[model samples]
Target: MHQPGTVSSSLHEHVQIGDTLLISAPAGMFTLDTTRTNPVAFIAGGIGLTPLLSMLQTVVKQQPERSAQLVYAVRDHHFHAFAEELQQLAAQNPAISHTIFYENGTEEDIEQKHCDYVGRITEAWLQQHIPADAEVYVCGPRPFMQAMISILLRKGITMENIHYEVFGPALAFSVD
Candidate 1:
């Protein structure tokens, strides 16, 4: 997890090879419509990458005709997980596109092509990069998801076409 909390951190610190951890089946409302052939765009922030990445992989493997776009934001390289796997997927699949944003990117990171953009994601950047007609799935911190949803709505994307999962308490937004 990118932003580990008390439970996750404790598990990481204390779990052993033979640890019998109780896990439940995955559940969430933010689901991908694999049956649709529309282009898929994923907007992820920090630890939110996990679910979105799974969807991306499924799309790549099961629906080769569908195009996928990933816009990932993280604190920096250290927090950027699945870097190699992402690169490999994009490299092997011409229909897949990956863009990464680093909040604390160094000059070397950009010069060496480690990140696509520096600084936090913005509404303008999202509008310019992500296709408005694409089916969008977003997962991120509460505030990030809120802002992304608001922006997508304002960009003329119907609420039904945008799906998101927030990490914290549920937040309500005023849809125009």
Candidate 2:
């Protein structure tokens, strides 16, 4: 769960096993581009994985030929949600590759969590993992998205190939 003030936490705490709840429909311009066939690279942090997971699931069902990789970063091993399902999906599907990173994890933690990498996700690490020319989709904290975007730009990834979405409250910073 995220925390007290976050959407994920609120839903987790209030929602019951058999309870029915009403919610607004999903509405967001940030979404996967199904037309692109060049391969997809999903970089998600914390709860941002939700939307990307949906996209990945769609890719598996609708376009199984598409090659996709997911790089996920979470606070720790125990805190990662839907981990077992993600790992199993990756293991069973040849078209998908999944890697998990823990920001505050030890080697033991990595082993226990069944995650691939430790520490925070880095641009260099991403470069080595994702396929070249893969279309990138990033969603995470503001600092993470900003950092990843900067690194991606430095690596010569065109603006057209990179997409992003922000969750929670936005930070105040002048674009100019």
Candidate 3:
């Protein structure tokens, strides 16, 4: 668990260890809730997809029946890390659905059919994709997370159902 108000840059450090990049134990507030069988939705942006990947791995190993929908947003396909792996996971797990939203991509560039949505995800996009009563987990840049949270609130999602994880130092965004 991350200490509230104590921002650390080392928490986001990535190192190459031989053939693999050694990622630290996902240090964030958001964790997969195995107890709940309700529909779960994950909103991740850029490198914020790390913890969500861990959650998905854990889910595949421990609780495979949990229904999940992951909406990942990135700048482009080349910048989208772990694309192949996520697609494979989604295909193997019947209960899991994954979608990618690329800021600079077309429908033909993506691997999965109807799984790619262009541009940033809005409240209307979320309302169309996610169920009315689903547990939503969001992790990304401060602006992206804030926007998603605002949309969720406007859609009448309870505060308890909306969880968030911030990576690295806290970002100070000017809302004005």
Best by TM-score: 1
For model 1, what is the C-alpha lDDT against the true structure? 0.86
Clash count for each candidate, listed in order shown: 0, 0, 0
Which is the leading candidate under lDDT? 1
Please give the ranking of all candidate structures by lDDT, highest first, separated by commas: 1, 2, 3
Q: If scored against the real structure, what TM-score would every candidate get?
A: 0.84, 0.79, 0.76
What's model 3's TM-score? 0.76
RMSD of candidate 1 to true structure, Å: 3.5
Model 3 per-residue lDDT tens digits across residues 53-172: 888777777878888888899888778978878989998999998988888877776554433777778777887888878888888877888888788877788878888886655443
Model 2 alpha-carbon drift over 4 Å, by segment: 1-28, 168-176
lDDT of 1 at 11: 83
What would the per-residue lDDT of candidate 1 be over residues 21-106, giving only the tens digit for each residue? 87654334688898899888999998899999999999989997788999999999999989998999899899999999999998
* lDDT string, candidate 2, 1-176, tens digits: 55544776777988889999876543334778888899898888888888889888988877788999988899887778788779877887898988898888789876675677778888789667766688888887777777776777667777678787755444332221
lDDT of 1 at 120: 86
Better of 2 and 3 by lDDT: 2
- lDDT of all predictions, in order shown? 0.86, 0.78, 0.78
* Superposed Cα RMSD, model 3: 6.7
